[model samples]
Target: MKVYLRQAAMAAGLLATAGLAGCVSAGSVQDPMSQPATLVPETKTGVVLDQLPPPARKLDVAVYSFPDLTGQNKPGENFAEFSRAVTQGGSAILIDVLTKAGGGRWFDVVERNELQALLQERQIIQNTRTAALGDQAPGLPPLRFAGISLQGGIVGYDSNETTGGLGARYLGIGGGTQYRHDIVTVALRAVSIQTGRVIASVTTTKTLYSVAVSGGAFHFVAVDKLLEIESGFTRNHPPTLAVREAIQLAVHALILEGVQNGSWSFADKKAGDAFIRSLETEGRAVIPVDALEPIAAAKPVNPPS
Candidate 1:
């Protein structure tokens, strides 16, 4: 009986290993090392942002800072990591999006994120000219001022909001998959530089996902002989990329809201109106339910009267 059980376990282990090998081999068929560097592909939100209609007049905008307000560290097991959960160069990403908005026709972005560095360079130039010409030196041109200022940051990050896994083993052979879901939220507001009032504000959320698949086996192949094997792979959605997508979506929503509220207008009125109507279904809102009638309190039961 023991001999038969050992044989069964060994056979099961071999079958499990073979099945996992087949799956892994499919992707390994390609020569990954030969792949060349290429431009990063656009996300869905980025594609829509690039396709937006041009505004009647580009708004002069400035982004002084966009920070990660979620102070959470990278998640791990049985260890502490000092690295943050998201990227630190959020302002750069936001500026890049703004510069590319409406095919570079929606915003006239100014350099406010590095204002000190710009001023210093300008001062150096002014000094050099004054010293070289002895009083006939021309003054540097005034920097462009922005009429609209963008303010916002990564407001929330929830790690492992949902997690699940499943697995089965018969005679010491098994395969399983595990998945986890995370969430990131961003808030953006366009403020009128002169009036100090928020022109348009938007909050956007994105879900990040990670999945892992693995197989392993342990069995006795012969008398006093034991064999074991393991194989696995993990796929994790990039947190920074998730942040970027959230920001892009926020920008798209902000533009649409601006149009809806008359804060801005598209160059082609008919096209703009049509586009807005098409996207109306994508907009979301939350409404609190009001009870039609209040429930009456239950009368206290009289004690055995």
Candidate 2:
């Protein structure tokens, strides 16, 4: 009987060891590449606009293309969805400001249908011209555009924490606290279409916050229950309000830069600057002369008339 008992204990120990080994092996079999890698932090670099040459002449500008302004969400398992969202949000705000300030002079701001037709024609003409040039035809004129500028690009939403709480009674030891934080980042750029140069670029970050209970007992609760509590709390605090404000602030910065230079008018600049300052006490943006230099440099040494 003693021998039989010993044999049984040995078998149990062996089985336990095998089980642990199997688990480790399984974990090791997982592809490391399958997991998302940590992203590196972005370094802020000053734009060297001063290197550009002086503007030959401000051409009668038109909105050649506007960023995606519909705020339409892309549907798919691709980064394009996120990209579209940012692009649309930033574009909408930028266009509104530009239209109001443009005094109808800065850009043509063509309608969607008209813009599409023009683009199609431009493409066809470009193709024909290319072919003609390739064949050494006599009458092919080079394509000419007065100016081009990036109105805006991807401006992401901001995040913040709205509420937090602690519940010691839930756990046997110290109370647990719950916390929530919201985060968002937005990107925007202004470009000179004629020179194909980016005149201004801005990125903004916003943070919001909320806190709740934290404890080991909280983890033991049903997932659905925890989620329900979180949802109810979040319902009290929507995230977009702070984000919208942040976006407006960023837009204001870009407009201020445009106004400082002759690209945008002073009246619009004053109104925008005031609007931004009203939001925050110290809302100010200064564009160095150096920044504009690059735009000048990008122009052809002797552009065609």
Candidate 3:
């Protein structure tokens, strides 16, 4: 009996050490609170947006608002919560995408989201100039007008669209992993400022994944003595980043749709046609992974005699 307990204690210690090593190697043990501020990491969709062909001429565009229409509350396992599931700064994300599209050669975005504040500031400048210089006061140049208005919003936030897990245990030592999937959708449209017409529109969707990994052991270290140890980590993909990717993809689609419908043109006809074909092929490859089916539980392992 003493020999059996000694062996079990050694096994538990080895299992615990291995779990700690795995977590550290995976780089999931660091505390993010200690990190310095950094620019948002670029996503796959953002990369494609940057690689798009230059437009024939930069279009003046305005994004007045991009509200969250879904009204989804953050999902919780135990209780209700008032916090929203998605970011409220959808307009800011859209504006940033427009400004960065095609390496800043696609669109000139105007400040329409805060038009009132801008106008007030301009008025203050004009009044000061008039008071100081009389009729010789130089006037502020006219505010640039937008030729096209971009309108859109985060339209959907579906939680727990897919969930699954797999686990195994042996000799009172084991590990398990679980994952959950969510989807976010965005829509964008370009409207002609003068014609009151929707020139182009596109909708895009992106998936968010949350995963957890855990390992633990329970063993008798000595007579009437027990040892228990657990190690694990959970990773949740930011919903805001998911929303940003969706918006970026929506912008990319809108640009392509515009080119196809003659609402816009590219700088080089041959290069543009080739680019369009390549992106269409890439678009079809963004299918979501299958994670809906629950994994079968692992059967217990018979202890060594």
Instruction: Give the root-mean-square deviation of each candidate in angstroms.
Output: 14.7, 16.5, 15.9
Question: What C-alpha lDDT do the candidate models reach, one value each?
Answer: 0.80, 0.45, 0.83
How many residue pairs clash in each candidate at the backbone level?
A: 0, 56, 0
The pairs that clash in candidate 3 are none
Task: Report the lDDT tens digits of candidate 1 across residue range 16-102.
Answer: 999876766543645343456686568988887887888867888889999999998998868998899888888998998888877
Output the worst ten-in-a-row residue range by lDDT, candidate 3. Answer: 287-296
Off by over 4 Å in 3: 1-33, 280-305
lDDT of 3 by residue, 36-79 (tens): 66998999889988988887778888899999999999999999
Best of the candidates, lDDT = 3
Ranked by lDDT from best down, the candidates are: 3, 1, 2
For model 1, where is the 10-residue window of minimal lDDT?
Answer: 287-296
